[model samples]
Target: MEIERSDRPPSRVNWLLRRVMRYFAAPRLNMREDYEKVRRVQRQLAVLPGPRFHALDVEIISADGDHPIPVRVFHPREQRRDEVLLFYHGGGWVTGDIESYTPACATMADLTGCVVASVDYRLAPEHPYPAGLEDCLRVARLLLADPTRAGIEATGEIVLVGDSAGGNLAAVVSQQLRDEGVAGAKRQILLYPVTHWDHDPATSEFASVRNHGDDYRLTNTEVQDYFDLYVPDAAQRKLPTVAPLMATDLTHQPDTLLITAELDLLCDEGEAYGAALERAGNRVRVHRVNGALHGFITLPRFSRSLREAYDVINEFLDERVPGKDAEDAT
Candidate 1:
């Protein structure tokens, strides 16, 4: 059941409309079929025109040397400092690669004027939990140690960004960094991140509302199923490292920008995490985009709220670390 939307101006023209069209036009598939469909859509996205910026393809050796992780680095046309963004793309931890998030990464790099490194981490049901987290941390350590490789300062601040499962990774990595006292990532950007494994009915209601009419895309059942595949053991829920919102301490981490799709099942959890951050006295800005659904960030064609999302994010980056362009204009 999708959410009943008010007949007003949609805050943005993103996937909500397209998915709604699909919901009516296509037949609802079973979990296996849905999984295949997701893959096909992702494959289509892998070839789209990504955001254009100064870019380089590179690889970082795993800290443990088990394998080398590939990363795509996007720099502002004008080099500025050691400041860089470490972005992880969301694909429910099962799919998605550097190509899947190309557009958003490109846009973020160009808009923020910071070198953006999109990490292609290990996926789950094959690699499992900490495998992805480990890859992200290893690459982060490597980047912070030498941001200058991409013309960024070695000691410059690093910002972590992710959407959906990628958002979960961003939170996990930042928390780990805080524990180790790794500096530079004073901020994190979460776009409709899934912060939990629990799927109670009330929250399911929210998911239904988020996709009330458009059932072709993400559904509440699908969310639960994905959790099953990624986490598997319910016992893992007790580990805050695994389920970030379940973590006891929220203090000492960098400030956060949490974006939620008002119609997304993950919406409530995202807000809850932001609230927790606020309660801990950390700076937090939460934006719930009305008429939007999960994964809207990737659908630039239907994203009426994309610019708004970009502004909210850039504003946060601006206040924390002023862009070089601002300085030049002064």
Candidate 2:
């Protein structure tokens, strides 16, 4: 039953992936050519074998904001369900968009039987700090206020889901909704999320950073680079709006499913956040999938680990959430 090494060594697929990633590694990050390398990488990956899940791409002008926020809605066959998920695509707060994450979103929609609305939030460096988060929060609030206007049924509930940098956005959004007394967000699913920013070079602590930091695709330094670009102000890093891990009050935050890859650099922070949420008395479940690497959710076609991750999420949803797979209104 236990094939993966608990010590978190690189799997055969990831070993090959490391080679491919290094091959496509970019020159450096700057404003002008920042997305080029990732673009190349995504192009290469697009050709790779992966699940083909299609969805209806819709454009909506936010009621609170003027930007044309593009959202991809994954509708199950026959009819649509009332529940919805606001998914944020992960690209280190810099490179990801809804298109890159469409396949995964559509798959999740099918699995969960809830319409998945993956938001095309503005990326960082070009947009920076609060810009992308603002887009997500606006989407949550606007959708909750008038779901029908956006073509989403009024389910009177929302689940926030994201991975990596997008997971950070999901956490902060949940915190804000809780703080503002917005009652719609009932659960949050954060996959290998970035929860804290203790940027002290001297501190090579934390079980994950000291252990699995090197072999993983998301290195500690790269994580720091993303944090720096997202929040240039060091003091602002302490703000709950930016980092939910630093939030003083974790009280009554949404019921959570925090999934962390055992080999990920962010594993400790994600687990710690789950602990803090438990301390705050919120129902939380955290899982560290064995031998999995970061961004596994986007690699369904390549990894069986992705299926395991889905199994955990589906178990959580069907067990905890009401209207689990309730028949679509014909």
Best by TM-score: 2
Give one digit per residue, the lDDT tens place, for model 2 in 34-75.
565775666566555655565777777755656788888777
Name model 1 segments beyond 4 Å from true.
1-37, 49-53, 77-82, 149-155, 200-216, 321-330
- Tens-digit lDDT string for candidate 1 (1-330): 122222345454477776665664323544433665666687797676555556688777777888878888887766544467889988778778886677777777766767788999987767777688899888777676666553444455778899998998899888887788775367789988878766555544345335432443555566566666667787885477777888788887777889877656677777888888888877788887777767777766346666667767777776743463484256
What's model 2's TM-score? 0.83
Candidate 2's displacement at residue 281, Å, is: 0.8
TM-score quality measure for candidate 1: 0.81
Cα deviation in Å at residue 289, candidate 2? 0.5
Off by over 4 Å in 2: 1-33, 47-54, 62-64, 77-82, 154-156, 199-201, 321-330
